[model samples]
Target chain A: MADIPIRIGIIGCADIARKVSRAIQLAPNATLSAVASRSIDKAANFAKANGFPPEAKIYGSYESLLDDPDIDAVYLPLPTSLHHKWAVLTAQKKKHLLMEKPLALNVAQFDEILKACEENGVQIMDGTMWVHHPRTYKMKEFLNDKERFGLLKSVNSCFTFFADPDFLKNDIRVKPDLDALGALGDAGWYGIRSVLWAADYEMPKTVTAMQGPVLNEAGVILACGASLYWEDGKVATFHCSFLSNLTMNLTAIGTFGTLHLTDFIIPYQEHEASYTTSSKPQFNELVTGWVPIPSEHTVTVNLPQEACMVREFASLVENIKKNGAQPDKKWPTISRKTQLVLDAVKASIEKGFEAVEIVS
Target chain B: MADIPIRIGIIGCADIARKVSRAIQLAPNATLSAVASRSIDKAANFAKANGFPPEAKIYGSYESLLDDPDIDAVYLPLPTSLHHKWAVLTAQKKKHLLMEKPLALNVAQFDEILKACEENGVQIMDGTMWVHHPRTYKMKEFLNDKERFGLLKSVNSCFTFFADPDFLKNDIRVKPDLDALGALGDAGWYGIRSVLWAADYEMPKTVTAMQGPVLNEAGVILACGASLYWEDGKVATFHCSFLSNLTMNLTAIGTFGTLHLTDFIIPYQEHEASYTTSSKPQFNELVTGWVPIPSEHTVTVNLPQEACMVREFASLVENIKKNGAQPDKKWPTISRKTQLVLDAVKASIEKGFEAVEIVS
Candidate 1:
């Protein structure tokens, strides 16, 4: 007999959830079991608009969705302020969790949520879809090659998108009471994560926030940057903004090579993604040109990144539910490290841009 | 009648002089008139190897070359410590100056050179060749466009090259007694110049050197970075190194657009140079990709950028020599501003990475 797919329910109909909802439908190992919203009309409308299965339940509240024993996993896309409560509750309910990024408002809250997941033996992974892309794996291979890339020396990652007037005035990201971390939590998460990914998840010794951060009237960050320093003299800087043009760049330089890509967060196309690498390039006779130019490598994707994320999450869920396997610590560990660095940047800004030491 | 090409003498046998000597020959408005070194045989061999014209003279010492009344200008490519003495004498000889950069050991010394040029009515332009590239002008047009680029917000510039062990031990750039400024003067000059060019040559309010700069045993910097902050909330950063793979990148983000290029200091190809620009890019439906992707533009080069630099410098010299016009102040002004910022970064590093205010 064919194995049953993991039954997944999404709690909260966030705008991003619409994308995840489609990903869940596309993933072969997962099935959308239900969706929840505070209002029954919203929940029912979201399910119908997203083409949910006819049998997929529509719960009026997130608590009702978690109460359902048939739901094997919860995809939580609530505002960051609400992540701690909903994420911990989902873990306590024994559901594998696909949590939205900035995993929680702070590392302490994330630690509590992580503890709950461990106690319940549930797998938890943040919804950073790009890391699951095939292209990312290819890039990682280049970074890991000792002869090609050599020792990591520096990395610079940036992600910025100009927020329209409507978004600036009405979006939850700008409201201090809502997504209080604003641009740092929302956009900077990718930059910091990319840096960590390049450094092989080695935490930095200190974080120094750049001096001039733009903040909204309610004290929510609209733009910011920070520099990270490691014990081995490796350094990295990242900039993120909701007030500049849409640009994503990751540049990692080593003793022997450089890796560069402009569209790291989201591919310019759905089918294939590309990155450029140069290994020990030499100058021409007159130093007028490169003798061997940088090469661009493309990875063809069989499935979109989000769907791949769903497949991976569901596969882990199936292993634990059917084969009695232990939860994987790799995913949650990386998420925690990303969150810890994010917290350091925020703390450095709060402390008048002083360098904040990262103990962990 | 065709105008006479400006007769240019090279003052030192520095490795860079070989390239600049070739540039002088290639420029339509300039000619290689003579070469000078402490050893007569070295000067004669340099002139012959670089294919200097049969009529071109070879001088046993820099003083003899400066006394050559036939030479209309001098291209001084001496070490940082020698720039002040040689450049001032070249100006006193009534020859226009095309001096290699880090114009002097400090801004004060640069100011003395500038004063000598002013007193002698001789044109002065530092050897920052990339700015002479036609592609640079195109990038500037985008940055200047009010609708397309909007307000300038941030810029990041980097230039690095892997130096061989012999060079690390023997190159003048790594010797405090010779160049003193080290990588900051050699490689960092390009990064700092690119940042200033992107910012329209505006002076920053303060400069903060990054904490973990690498210095040689003789207290000469091998790698360093700094952040520049403007009063209007604009910010920029630059990193330069002598221990990393050869990589050059300049990224400038405005409110409505972004401008990026990987080979800003030296084009990957001589015949054509390219940069990428994105104006008001939008995310595709579901935010999986971008709509109306960033565009790459290429500018064909009729003459190499270094030759273009020689041509521009020669043309300025011609106007003063033939038309009896005053020397242009634009080039020296920008050069001064660049040196001022460089001085601030050096000061910040000496001050334990403290923020150093730019009084200018």
Candidate 2:
């Protein structure tokens, strides 16, 4: 006697939803129940192209998807500016919410969505797939080991991708009216989240935007960076860009060890992911080489990271629905913290790159 | 027939000298001819313990070693404060010089040493051995390839090592009267040098130090970082510390490719070094993984990087000695540029983390 799968409805035909739809199919605990696009023909085409189940419903408008009583949750991959409106409505309709990150335009918008989810007793989790990867768990274990890693000292994370000319000119990310936050919201989100994750979610004392951020004519960021400082002498810096090649790096250093990975956001292969770690490395006798070199750890993924993310989210939703339990606060709490740091970095840049003290 | 090997005398019995003495012996075109210390017994012991030639002379003072006509060049590993004094003396004595990095306390002091070398017609090179590694040349080829790497966009380099309490209290690096720049010089040197190497030695337009630099009681920096901006929208940041586990990372991103290495300062093994490069990598169709994944390149070394450095320096000295060629200006020019950026970072920190414009 297996439990019924969580029925997940995707409320937008965004490019990212295509991947998430596949993930929903791959996740054993979730099933694609519905998909919606503003136009009926587009919704039908997306459903047909993405291999939506024969029983999956196709809706011309997001409101219809939210009204579907069979749907247990909604995966919202809308642009940043639209998150608040749709996320709040999805929560009001009592559907669990799985939202693409830059969770909201700012913390305030995200707070409203959280409030809605709380009032409706619905689970909410941001769509940051990497955190759910089994490899991430192994890396966190390394970071938390007192004998190996000791106290955390610093972190440096970067996520950059070269945006082709047509995309830069027309992509919703570069349009101030649509995504608005641009590269910082789209890419810097991962960097900020990685830093916070490395620090065990301890908020930094201040965030300072690095000089020379590149912006488009519409006042949207194309490339940017920021440094964060903690009261206890820990420091981190992150850089994100749409003008550079695809490179994702996360490096965390502790008193006695270091952890590094280049493909933090996306694995190089679907079935496996790997990271490198060094603990108490020493120089060779002649000082010409490392005595004990760093070691690489690879985690075999039974399912892709995105599918793992879907399974985790759907499991939370099932707990809330089938067990009559409250919505999980952990996911929303982490999402809000990431958005808080993102806001600070943007505010610091707007205030002439001055230090912005994080209130929380 | 091969030309006579360059006879190199080392001034100062610093721990680094023991390694370089071995390098000089291993270098095909160099031979250790003498060593000097404030105490003749120390010099004699170092010469004997480091396998210096049995006929090698032992001098009680640096001045005496500089005066030895049989020595064609000198390796200077004295404290940073003494670099201005001994480096100038080595050049004035017409001995080609291989001096340790953080060439001087400031560019002004380094410029004076450069002037002395110019006037004496002696070659001078800093002991930044990694640039001489064969792997570095391979990496450069990728960076310079337009089809593979495209235009350089950013770089992030870090070098850190945990220092015991004894070193924090007694090491020359932490003493104001000795290596006054502290970790900013001793550890930050490699970070800055790596950034410069990745950027093709092009000077950045501005240097801004990151906030929250940790300083000792004597106002010596124990940890610090900076961001450098180039006029062409290229950016680079580096962090260096004496308070974290040994970690060296160099990540460079271009429009079409990325280059990364974990042990950029010292190879993990004496016989070979490796780096990773991703050229025009693409996400898989479902966005769960990468297509045409990154490739690792390994370069075998016949001798250690330090030996390679010594051989290159000795070969330059031989060219000037036997071919009547002028001393190569390339090495000093790069050393000066690196020092200039370092000075700007220090100035920026002192001025409350303001951005400091680099004149040259």
Candidate 3:
């Protein structure tokens, strides 16, 4: 218990795998021991570049990597469309898994993966890296401190970027099987995950979606608008677009005041965040002489923490070793619910941005 | 073409009636000649309070007001639940009519109103007061000028306020017959109207909506959200609430920059609006080179434009006289389309925020 390192095997040598590889090397208890890619040349190149021990095994296929006896766990950074197949196969191998955002293309697929993991007694954690970031923790802490920011009213977010044509060509994101809600699936997921996590995983009771035309492939939504209705009457609205240029913003408004955080989708370590709150209207107006809240406050967060994906995977390993279960009991449950919401979004788009409910 | 005073009659002593009364008294070519309410006492009180002529007729009902020979036009401020009934009746009297927003609660009702007006040769305009305001005109002009603000990407608006318990107690807004989406019927319409008008009435090809719980006997909607999908691939999302404190904001993000205009629901004349746009990112590096677009050379609009609404209405009337057809081909058509969108919102809410298509 003092200091135990988990031997981690990464399956898939995509751009994200490199970040996870570094995180594994950095984490005190996580050691990246092996890596696999669809191509042997790519796997060999990645392993040699990362200086994996000579004994570390490399495979051209994910299944061969999963079969390795020395690999304790596997990180799956495969294309979103392939998340389910690999996740289930990894769980069956009894290997703990770290799956990427949009755990699957649909709710049914996510449920299937969850069931497989549960049956195989393998811990699974979604690679929603932002959720594991310290800034997110600080955000929750700030939101919960009613004395700091009053009753939460609404949250609005926008995360979009114009993609290069090369990035779109033959990308799994443009594949028909994924039902990608374009920006909603690619960048919008960050905003969705942020709000769902910040709001204590309260699944929106109702959802309405509006989408623009296909900017790339048919049914590949370029822009989408969503309205989420919460049980306590809190409302959140978000916009995701691929047709527009790069822009990211997140705003949380409460009774006492409001909070605006930019670059919420990415780590604050890489990008700076700014916030402002109204001053004239007192936070605690009931307190006769309560010092008037500052009209606005702007601060940048600078922190050195493990990469998001790496941190979550390491935490899952630690949680499994200590408690024999995932750290957050609600994460998997809410994650599947998020997938259901995404399904509704796709349905809404197909039906011309019609409202679609997340049926429990 | 000689200057002629426009004689107007009031068909209901509603809250909107008061606003219209004020606007009429302030318009140069418009004069309020009569007032009507369901109750004689209310009609008499309104007529006396607003300084109507000593002989100015006070009718006990809308029908009696329409029967008055001296009245040239009628402002129908009836509840949305009853708009169709009074609108059709008033149009049948061949009186130029200005009906309150939403036009009618449903598409069929709106069609009936328009058809009745056409048959009777009466000029009818939806009482969308904000659309006729000088500030709105200025905003449109600003958007249209490429050098000022170009290539609108998205528009988001919030029109929210807590409803007065006393007012909700007696208001027809709470009645089941209203087919009201509560906050949506009450305020969300304004947000939708703004986006639609700003985009030149390009009807959204599809729409979806989510509504919060109904809290009172009047079926008051606590909160509502809607997404509109335009044919040209533009998307707009909005939120409205009546269960919480007041907050009004409108933000339009464009390719060049963003325009943030607060308190968009109320006439800008009642509030001051300041906008900041930067081509150089002033907030952070991610937002770099977003300098504020200067407004020094932009046209300034002086409001309380004495005859803004009356003038627009008169222009419509004159256009009808000249063209021997609908004033602006877009007016009635867009009004009907807007009603259809509202109906779709209602349907989405009723169906648990399910996507509802805007059938032609």
Model 3 lDDT tens row, A1-360? 665667789898876676667667766667788888889889999988876768678899888999987777888887778888899999899888877777888888888998988888777777666565566666676667676556677778787554556656656666666535555677767767766765777788777665554556466766676767777777787777755544556666665545555446553234343344442232122111113322333334333234555655667767776668743445687677667777777776677655566788
lDDT of 2 by residue, B183-257 (tens): 999889999988999899999999999999999999999999999999999999999999999999999999999
DockQ order of candidates, top first = 2, 1, 3
Q: What is the TM-score of chain A alone in each candidate?
A: 0.99, 0.99, 0.87
Native-referenced DockQ of model 2: 0.88
State the lDDT at B184 in candidate 1.
92
Clash-forming residue pairs, model 1: none
The candidate with the higher DockQ, 1 or 3, is 1
lDDT of each: 0.94, 0.94, 0.67
Error of 2 at A231 (Å): 0.7
Off by over 4 Å in 1: none
- Which of candidates 1 and 2 reaches a greater DockQ? 2
lDDT string, candidate 1, B102-133, tens digits: 99999999999999999999999999999999
